[model samples]
Target: MIDETAEQLRERVAVELERARARTALLTDAVDDDDLIRQHSPLMSPLVWDLAHVGNQEELWLVRDVGGRDPVRHDIDELYDAFKHVRADRPQLPLLGPAEARGYVATVRDKVLDLLGGVPFEGRRLTTDGFAFGMIVQHEQQHDETMLATHQLRVGPAALNAPPPPPAGARVAGEVLVPGGPFTMGTSTEAWALDNERPAHVVDVPAFFIDAACVTNREYARFIAEGGYSQPRWWSEDGWRHRMEADLTAPMHWQRDGDGWAYTRFGRTEPVNPDEPVVHVCCYEAQAYAAWAGKRLPTEAEWEKAARFDPATGRSRRYPWGDESPSAHRANLGQRHLAPAPAGAYPDGASPLGVHQLIGDVWEWTSSDFVGYPGFAAFPYREYSEVFFGPKYKVLRGGSFGTDAAACRGTFRNWDFPIRRQIFSGFRCARDAEPV
Candidate 1:
């Protein structure tokens, strides 16, 4: 970032900001006004709330903070204040309707782009290397993904469409060996990295074997076939209790289709694709499945090392493939596909240790709680990550198909309650290495 010239950074920031807005448009425009306003599920916000909130954030951060311009809509600040309101209760508030939300975001975007055309890229921490702009872009992309999940939950016809991901390329190795050693975790220098991913640190992990790609639907089906879910031995006390209470017999949106199973994706029901990585399984489910298969979920540090470490050079990469940016050919990101590409679809995207599909497809559950690393400090604000740091949330590494490249990186961190299943999540298994 420091090496890039002012013009280069501006162009990059503009492109990212535009990309995020374009996606927001696609997700919201596909649904009607009523659909946007309806609360599809208690767990997610109404589409209209998301639309206006995106604009509110842009106005608060860019239009006011970095640009030093007056508030664009100060009166509506509390209406969209996420901390003040909860997701289930947001619809009862007087949120901007569909058309009004669209207009507000458009107005904010126009001002932001105008400011970007001349805003200096140096001085303040927020402005340095255009980090604030990057933060806004990531925040918007994250919401866009949330909106995509809402579409999945909405009760209606298929409101969105996209060609399926590519088929599997070759017979990828089932698992790969990651030799035990200390490697760098998180980021210290990567531009646009969020507050929690800062102040890079080293973690010494024991040698372990991890799935080369994510655990595929075909692989997960085996666990189901063997009556994995019915057994309590594979499940922990909490997971067993939750399973009994929820009566969760299968992954969300899955149902018995005669002798096999079918899955509902964005309102379209079809036979589950055997070769694609299994999604919508909560951390508890993943943990149970791993136990049934005689394996365990990787630790957060192990997941990062497998995705970033290069044994030959003893240096971590910015992504699984290399330092290059993500693209259609490299990863299944940015809503380019409605579903995960078949396992082993992107051969070139494999990490140095031959781990495939680590970048995009599904967020892999890890066996670690969300907490700050040593020497951690809250920068700018504490709400973004600090508030959620505890044993309540488990870490999820990697990114999903709905995730945008701007919001994901090898060092990026995502955490959620272990019981959440509606989000597009999946897992891979790991096992201790043999005696040295």
Candidate 2:
């Protein structure tokens, strides 16, 4: 076993390496060599290039950072490296087989672990351009998820399956009743936060009672059974438009079979477990559900305050569990799979105020819009947040089971189009300034 410090670094590196391997397999497993060359959209790259691209990223960061021990493979520039080449030219490049590309990925990760092992955690930023070592760990994990999505798009439902649905109606009791005080909110550090989380500032909120756990399918059914979708007052105009345009009567992929509800996941159809967190519901769906329940979603500030500002600590944290990195027992992340785990599976990852599952399982919808913080600045990844500060998107906190533990930090921000429902998403509810 590795020591605590060494263990943390090793765990971080090992998790990425494992994800890289899974991604490579996912890309190659059921995909045909011909289909790999077809264009899906400019946003996605060819499956054949996935490993090579990951290898190029690893070489750029880990290998080059260690010492220019290896001149990157000559053709890697044309074959991968989106920053260097356009998607239009991807099919023309030579591709490496699963084994060879994964080998390169492994070698690079081993070198990063070796180099990181000797360095202290304090103030250790890996990139000369100011990217932290943590960012590299997170970058690889993000790529892993991309590969999963890519495979799912290219190969169909068999390519990716979500985890088992959580048990229905499982109630986790405990709520932090905030008195609705004036609290400082937003990002505070330049450490590793995205631009939108910057310009750290303050916001005063009224006291409210937020559900300890996210809303479950069983709870949602009560609304649906009573014609939640039929009620215009429960939905925003935009949400109603989306519902009508998409002809959505229930959560995406859910259907009514006979007198009961069934859902399709990972290519298989199963009975909806009413008590489990309602997976695949979009922001619009969550909003409607909340309104029907006579509650509302918490603002990002309210969510952060409940988890970060303690009567004792009086500060936001990198994680709800304080300043430490997450472990397997802490959150259901970095598990090399895209799915919402049980909400109560990670009690250890709870916030200081007893907020459960504040780190992972699913990305919780915050009432906040995706916007710039008070004094935001662009970094090397200039398009990161600046490109999405518009009104069509919303902010999601906590990470999903599909995320890397490193990316599951409390300060992390995930934004999505308000009506998009393809991701592993769910939501918790907040009530107006009162105890339950």
Q: Candidate 1 lDDT, tens digit per residue, 261-307? A: 99989989999998899999999999999999899999999999999
- Candidate 2: tens digits of C-alpha lDDT, residues 90-173: 666666765566566667766765665555454543442233454565666676656554543443446454455333223476
Instruction: Provide TM-scores for the models.
Output: 0.98, 0.77
Displacement of residue 209 (Cα, Å) in model 2 is 2.3
Q: Return the TM-score for candidate 2, rounded to 2 decimals.
A: 0.77
By summed lDDT, which 10 consecutive residues of candidate 1 come out lowest?
1-10
Identify the runs in model 1 with alpha carbons over 4 angstroms from their true place: none
Clashing pairs in 1: none
